[model samples]
Target: MNRLRILLADDHPVVLAGIRALVEAEPDMEVIATAADGTAAFDLADRLRPDVAVLDMSMPGPNGAEVAERIARYCAQCRVVMLTVHEDRAYVRRLLEVGVAGYVLKRSAPAELVRAIRAVAAGGLHLDPAVAALAICRDPPRPAAPEAAAEPTEREAEVLRLTAAGHGNKAIAQALGIAVKTVEAHKANGMGKLGFRSRVELVRYAASRGWLGSLQP
Candidate 1:
C-alpha cells in the first residue's frame, strides 16, 4: 500500500515530537520531514513535495499563511493542513484565501489532527468544530449596492452553503437529492447573484453570514 507522506512544522520541540509520534503511529501515514520554522517548512515542502504539510499558524521566518501561500503557488500538488492554536476568524479567513485545506486547533483531541490530515489528503476540507462556530459570529459582509445584484434564492442559498462547507458538486447533489447538473446550476446562479468569483470568496461570505456553522469534517 502507498503510505501518505507528511511534513510537520512547529517551533516547540516537545509539541513537535508529540505530533510526530501521533502521526507515525498511524499505519497508513508517514512523517517524511519536520521543521521548527516556517521557512524550513516551505523549503522542505518544496523539495520533498509531501502529500500533506501540517503547519503551526505562528512560526519564525515566514509564518503559516505566508508558507501556505508560497506552497500553494509553487507546490500545487501538496495539500496544507494548519495545526494551530489560533481560533480567530481573521486567521481562518486568511488561511482559506491562501488555499489551506484544513484547519485543526492544537487544543483539539489528537484524533482530530489525524482526521484533518486524512480529510485534506483525500481532497476535503476540515475545520475544527470549536472554530467552526466562530464563522457564524463574525461581522456581517459589507453591503452591496441595491442594484448591484439580486439575493440568492432559497435553493441557490442551499447550494452555496454546502459549497462553502467544502462539498463538491456531486456530493452536494447526493446530499440534496438533486441532479449534478442542477447542483452546478444552483452553484453558478448563487455565485453570480452574490458576485463571488471564487470558492474563497463564497466561503468568506458564508463565514460572515454564519452559514458555515453546520460544517463537518
Candidate 2:
C-alpha cells in the first residue's frame, strides 16, 4: 500500500510535534516535512508535493490561505486542510474562497484531524460541525451564484481560474488587463456564488471543476 505523504505547518513547535505524532502513528500516513510558518510550509510543499498539507490558519509570511494557494498552483494533486483555532465564518469563508478542502479546529480531537486529512485526500470537503453550524445560522454573504451555482461571469471565471492558479489579486489584474478592484470584485463574486466559506474550498471547487487547467504554465 502506498503511504500517505503529509506536510505539517504550525507556528508552535509543541503543536507541530503533537500533530506529527498523531499523523505518523497511522501506518498508512507519514510526515515527510514540518514547517513553522507559512513561508516554510510553501517551500516544503513546493519541494515535496505531499499528498496532504496540514496547516495552521495563523502563521508567518503568507498565512495558511496563501500557502494553500501556492500549493494548489504548483502541486495540483496536493490537498490542503487548515488546522486553526479560529471559528469565525469570515476566516472560514476566506479559506474556502481560495479552494481549501478541510477545516479542523485546534480543539478538536486528533481523530478529527485524521478524518479531515482522509476526507480531503479523497477529494471531499470537511468542516468542524460547530463552525459549520455557526456559519449556517448567520447567513453570511454569498459569492458566485445561487441555484446550480452557475459558472461565474467571464471576468469572474477568469479571476477564479487565476486564483486557483495561485495568482495574487494584483498579479491577476495585471495579467487580465483589469483593475485591481475589479479583480477583487470578480473574485468575491466567484466565491459568493460557490458559497465557499474559505479560500480552501474555493481552490478545491475550482480544481475539481478543471478551471485551473487553463492557467497552468
Candidate 3:
C-alpha cells in the first residue's frame, strides 16, 4: 500500500519537531525529509520529490514563498503547502498566485495541517477558513464582458455561495450530491459570468448577490 510521503520545512527547531511528530502520527502520512531553511528545503524537495511539501512561509534564505515558487516550477509533481503564521489576505492571495496548493496558518489546529497536506496531495486547494473569510483583494483590472458576465444559473449560484463560504470543491460536491468536476465547471462558469478572478472576489460577489447567507462586510 502506498502512503503519502511529505517533506517538512521550518526554521524553528521545536516547531519542526512538533509538526514532524504530528505528521508521523497519522497512519496515512509519513515525513520523508526535513529542512531548517528555505534553501535547504528547496534542496531537500529536489532530492526527495515527496508527494507534498509543507513549507514555513517565513523561513530564512530564499524564504518559503520563493521555495514554493521554485517547487511549483521545478517539481511540478509535488504539491506545495505553505505553512505560516500569516493570515493576511494579501499574503494568502499572493501565495495562491504563486501556485501553492494549500495555505494554512500556524495558529490553526494541527489537524488542519494534516487535512491540508492530504487535500493538496490529492490535487485540491485547501485554505484556512479564517483567512479565507477576509476575502477582499486587489487585482489588475480586466475589461468587463457584460454579455459573458450575465446572471449565473441556479446551480452556479449554489456552487459559488458554498465556495465563497470557504468550502473546498470536494466538500461542495458532496453537499450538492454532484461530481467534483461538475462543481468546478459551475464555479468557473459563474466566475466568468460575474467577472470574478479569485475565490475571495467570488465570495464578495456572492455576498453582494445575497447567495451566501451571512458572510457580510
Candidate 4:
C-alpha cells in the first residue's frame, strides 16, 4: 500500500516535533515536509502536494482558512486539516464555510489527530468530538434559523457541503466516489440553483442552511 503523505505546519518547533512523531509513528503514514509558518506551509504544500496538510489555524500570512482555500485552488488533490487550540464555533464555522475537511483542537490527543487524518483521507469529515458538540449546542439559533430556503438537489447539497468544507473538485470526487467532472457539474448546478455567483455567497447560503453541520469537519 502507498504510504499516506503528510505535511506539517506550525510555528512552534516543539509542537511540530510532537506532530511529526505522532504521524511518523503510524506505519501507513509518512511526514513529507514541515513548515514553520503559514506562507512556507502554502509554498511547500504547493510544491510537494502532499496527500494531507496539517496546518495551524493561527499561522502567519494567510491563516488557516486562506491557506485551505489556496490549497484547494492550487493543489486540489491535497486535503487540509486544521490543528488548533480554538474552539470558537464561529471560527470553525467560517473555515467550514470555505470547505475545510477537518478541524482538530490542539488539546486533542495524538491518537485523535491520527483518527482525524484517516477519517478525512477516507473522504469523511472529522471534527474534534468536543468541538462538534459545542458547535451543535452552543448557538443553536445560528444554523437553526435560516432566513431562506435555497432549494438544491441532493447531489448539489453534497457538493455545497464539501465545497464549503474546503474540498476541491478532485477531493470531492474522491470523497463522493464520482468523477471530477461530475463534481464540477454538481458544484455548478448547486451554485446556479442557489443563484450564487461566487464561492463566498455559496458558503453563506450553505451556512444559513446548516449544511456545514452535516460535514465531517
Candidate 5:
C-alpha cells in the first residue's frame, strides 16, 4: 500500500516537532512538509495537495479556518483537520463551513491526532470525544419542535445527526457507505418528515436531540 502524505502547520516549534514525531512514527504515514503559520500552511498544502493538512487553529497569518477554505478552493481533495485550543462552537461552525474534515483538541492531540488524520484522509469525520460534544451546536432551522405527526427512520436520523455535526453531504455519504445522492434523499426526507425546512432547522433539531455526541464512525 502507498503511504499517507501529511502536511502540518503550527506556530510552536516544540508542538510541531511532537506532532511530527507522532505522525512519522506510524508505518503508513509520512510527513512531507511542515509549516510554522497559516500562510505557509496554505501555500504548502495548496501546492503539495497532501492527503491531509493538520493545522493549528490560530496561526500567525490566515488561521486554520482560512487556510482550510483556501485549500478546499484550490486543492479540493486535500482533507483538513484542526488542532485547536479553542473548543468554542463558533470556531467549529466556521471551519465546518469551510469544509474541514476533522476537529481535534490540542489536549487530545497526542492520543487522537493520528486517528483524526487517517479518518479525514479516508473521507470520514473525526471529532475528539470532548470536542464533539461542545464544538459545534447547529442552530435549529425552526423555532418550535418538530410536529409530532411525523418522525424519521433510523437511517434518516443518522444522516441528520452527522449533517448537524457539520459533515457535508459527501462526507456523510462516505461515513454511512451511501451515495451522495442518497444522503441528499435521506436528509430531504427526514427534514420534511420533521418539518425541518432547511439545514439550519435540521441542525437545531439534532442539537436539541443531543445527536452531535453520536460520533459513531
Candidate 6:
C-alpha cells in the first residue's frame, strides 16, 4: 500500500510537534518534511512535492495564503490543507481562492487534521464546521434579477450541495443513487445557473446558503 506523503508547516514549535505526532500516528500517512516558517514550507513543498502540505495560517515570512498561492503556481501537483485558529470568512475566502484544498481549525480535534489531509489528498475539499458557519452568518441572500437564469431544480441543488460538501462525482452518485453522468449533469447545470465557474466559487456559494453546514469536522 502506498502511504500518503505529507509536509507540515507551522511557526509554533509545540503545535508543530503535536501535528507531526498526530499525522504520524495515522497508519496511512507519513510526514516527509516539516517547516517552521512559510518560506521553508514553500521550498519544501516545491522540492518534495508531497501529496499534501498542511500549513499554518500565520507563519513567519509570507503567511499561509501567500505560500499556498506560491505552491499552487509552482507545485500544482501538491495539495494544500490549512490549519488555522481563525474562523473569519475573509481568511477562508482568500485561502480557498488561492487553491488551498482544506481548511481545518486548530481548535478542532486532532482527527480533523488527519481527515483534512486525507480528503484533500483524495481530491476533495474540507472545511471546518465553525468556519463554514461564518459564511452562513455573513453572506446575505441576493435577490435574483429578471435577467438571471432560472434557479436550479431540486436534483441539481442536491447534487451541488453534496459537491460543496467535498464529495466527488462518483461519491455523490453513490450517495444519491444516481449515475455518475447524471451527477455531472446536475453539477454542471447547477453551477451554470448560478454563474459559478469554479469549485471554489461553488463552495463559497454553498456556504453562503448554509448548504455546507452539514459537513462535520
Best by lDDT: 1
Off by over 4 Å in 3: 136-144, 147-217
Question: Residues 41-156, candidate 6, lDDT per residue (tens digit)?
Answer: 99999899898999999999999999988887777667788999888788887777677778999899988888788877776677777786564335544444445568999999
Q: 1-217 in candidate 1: lDDT tens per residue?
A: 8999999999999999999999999999999999999999999998999999999989999999999888877786688899888888878878876778789999999999998888777756678888865543354444544554788999999888766655556656777899989998998888877767766667767766767443441
State the local distance difference test value for candidate 2. Answer: 0.76
- Rank by TM-score, highest first: 4, 1, 6, 5, 3, 2
Ranking by lDDT: 1, 6, 4, 3, 5, 2
**TM-score to native of every candidate shown:** 0.72, 0.66, 0.68, 0.75, 0.70, 0.72
Q: What is the C-alpha lDDT profile of model 4 across 39-117, one tens digit per residue?
A: 9999999999898999999887888888887887888878789998898777777766565678899998878899888
Clashes (backbone N, CA, C under 3 Å), per candidate, total 1, 31, 0, 7, 3, 0
lDDT of 5 by residue, 1-217 (tens): 7999999999999999999999999999999999999888988887887998899998999888888878866776688889998877777667666767788988874768888888777656677777565433433244434354667899999988776654667667777899989998998888778776554455446655766443442
TM-score of 4: 0.75
10 residues in a row with least lDDT, candidate 2 = 208-217
lDDT of 2 by residue, 50-102 (tens): 88999998998999999887876666667888999899878877776676767
Candidate RMSDs in order: 6.2, 8.3, 6.9, 4.7, 4.9, 5.9
List candidate 4 segments past 4 Å from native. 136-166, 173-185, 191-217
User: Residue 47 lDDT in model 6?
Assistant: 90
List the lowest-lDDT window of 10 residues for candidate 3: 135-144
User: Of the candidates numbered 2 and 6, which has the greater TM-score value?
Assistant: 6
Error of 6 at 150 (Å): 8.9
Q: Score residue 123 of candidate 6 by CA lDDT.
A: 61
In model 5, which residue pairs have backbone atoms overlapping below 3 Å? Answer: 140-204, 141-200, 141-201
Off by over 4 Å in 5: 135-214
What local lDDT does model 5 show for residue 76?
64
